[model samples]
Target: MPLRQTIARYFSDHAETNDSHTDPLLQTHYYKITADKGVTILESLFRNDPLYDIHASSSDRGEISATITERKKAFIVATVTMVKPLQTAIDFSVTTESFLRFDLGFSHKVIQRLYAHTDKELPLVKNIEQQPAHR
Candidate 1:
């Protein structure tokens, strides 16, 4: 199966639950990633500033969610829903490097530009509180 197809299937089979505390539907077995690089890249390309609130699942099928609060607004803006396999992370390291090499050789500046913007937005992302802290 293709990577995108597999990701879609994982989300389809999962159950979604509402999290009143964070005000987002929590899907079981997901990993939330709010990297600054990803945020900046999305905003520049999509014209949408990302808050990096992603609800995702891990390879083990454990449910999780994320919320990235905006500096001005005390709420999340970017909500992502998907599932990524553990193996993909490893594959990405090599594949991404290769892709970058190819792009650089061909003088394709798009990737460089995208990554630069993503770097700007990355510092704003922070993980959402998942557990109740004891006083």
Candidate 2:
């Protein structure tokens, strides 16, 4: 299935079960993959800008890392650090909520954009083989 359809089906089937606190219209899944020691810093920074539309080209230097963990269920976490030339890095995480809250078309488009933005950082993930993973 296309990402859009898959996302919608996912939300329809799973949203309410996650929690009563999770709004079916605003349910969000969190992804947090990080380097061995960098998870803490990444988590802190990402929580600050969960929905920020950051671009990869905006940074001069940065790191990309991820980790997969099971919290009630399986989820992947992606950490991005966009560093400006000689400046402190702007780090954040993008989350894919289990529940579908937004329009499927919009959700798919946004994710596609983020996917392209992330692929630009391929040079950054040198040690590990890049996986064809998506939320």
Candidate 3:
């Protein structure tokens, strides 16, 4: 990567999940569960965690918004979508609160840890149609 890009990544205060993200860590995660179940799993994750404060959640919309009130202050949104009866996709967007331009990849690390915990709660489903980038 170019120095500028590296610097931006290290300093960026925002991170989100994307299907074709250049960074594999930000790739969208699919799980083998229903959207409702996915939402329930995520809701419990925030409700049970002392560090997180769930601001709002909607099962109809399949969305959960929370704030990291401890350790590091940040806002996060988790989106759950049902692709099939038993297949669901979960995406997370995190933005850290700070006066500085970046948090040294703190937001990135938060997403990674969230994914790790989620992976344990629900089975991960690999992409069925992963296509290589054109050279």
Candidate 4:
């Protein structure tokens, strides 16, 4: 099963509480890349894609915020942190503007798509196996 489906199932099985304060789901994924490169790639992706509207970005700070309008408006904030010379962490926070408080795994789908796009755009370091998420 897809990660998003798995997460949704887990939440459903556990009877996870949904509160107004926590309506926006936050997800973090680590990628193998420098912070600078990560920010550049994200900027390019967001700027080039018609689906995303860039709200704010600071390459120096390694952060990008954008908004996407599908059935609902989704606000996305992505941050890149350098953990090592070539290891970086990417965090994505997605909030949807909806009448209902819960997203029913919409945020997870956004994160999964973003992560897949990043992986496709950026090539891995030569002879280095991709590492799993750190923490």
Candidate 5:
């Protein structure tokens, strides 16, 4: 990890999944599922969890936003996109309520946990590992 990222992990209150993120765990995840199904699965997960209080969701846009009201306070948004018929992408953004914009990487941890939960409910299409190398 770079110095700046390490600093941000401990000193910042926000974290998000991006295509270019250095950490693969923090990168966008693809699964073999439809966008609507992905949205339903995630919404169900959040609704079932007592810690999560779902506030808004749009199946057409494939977005589900929720807030964590127990143990800590944090807002999270999960975006699902259909790249193809059965290929879907999921990404997360989390911001925690803390003083001095400090959550000790709480936002990052929350995203990781959410991903883990979602992963259990779907099959993730592995990224490019089996492709033949070309010179």
Candidate 6:
């Protein structure tokens, strides 16, 4: 057997699983932006990354799904939801294609990088007014 296959067989949690693992690595993040803008920004981010290829997107639904092939073949899905006027939530799911059961924290690293990039790219608000007390 090949070196990679031998190592994978030794390190893998379960060998019975199929070649491509179906489990998803998931993470959710909150940001200060409207859902619409968040969708646009995320889409742009994914498209700009050479490692990723956007396969499906719905601006109206604030969802984007893409394939990433760098160190490993993976699928990424992101969803943006509006929690308040100035608050939004983004969720990411990464599924890697590998014989090994674990990705060695690769998915987490991807999420961290994405969050850092998004945070840096988002515009900062300069002013904010406190809400008035209810009468």
TM-scores for candidates 1 onward, in order: 0.21, 0.26, 0.91, 0.69, 0.93, 0.69
**Tens-digit lDDT string for candidate 5 (1-135):** 889888878898899997678877798888999999999999999989999999999999999999999887999999999988898989999999887778998998998999899899999886555347889
- Model 3 segments more than 4 A misplaced: 1-5, 131-135
Answer with 3 or 4, whichever has the higher TM-score: 3
Taking the tens digit of each residue's C-alpha lDDT, what string does model 1 give over 43-100?
4443443643444424332222333334311111232333242211000000112222
On TM-score, the candidate that comes out on top is: 5
Off by over 4 Å in 1: 1-44, 48-107, 124-135
Q: Candidate 5 — worst ten consecutive residues by lDDT sum?
A: 124-133
Instruction: List the candidate 2 regions with Cα displacement exceeding 4 Å.
Output: 2-101, 124-135
lDDT of 2 by residue, 82-107 (tens): 22322121222334344444333343
Candidate 2 has a TM-score of 0.26
* Sliding window of 10 residues with minimal summed lDDT for model 2: 13-22
lDDT of 2 at 47: 42
Please provide, for model 3 over 1-135, each residue's C-alpha lDDT reduced to its tens digit, 9 standing for 90 to 100: 568766877889998998888778889999999999999999999999999999999999999999999877999999999998788999999999989868898899999999999999999998776656569
Best by lDDT: 3
Local distance difference test values of all predictions, in order: 0.29, 0.33, 0.91, 0.68, 0.90, 0.67
Give the distance in Å from residue 63's predicted Cα in candidate 3 to where it truly belongs.
0.6
Candidate no. 5 TM-score: 0.93
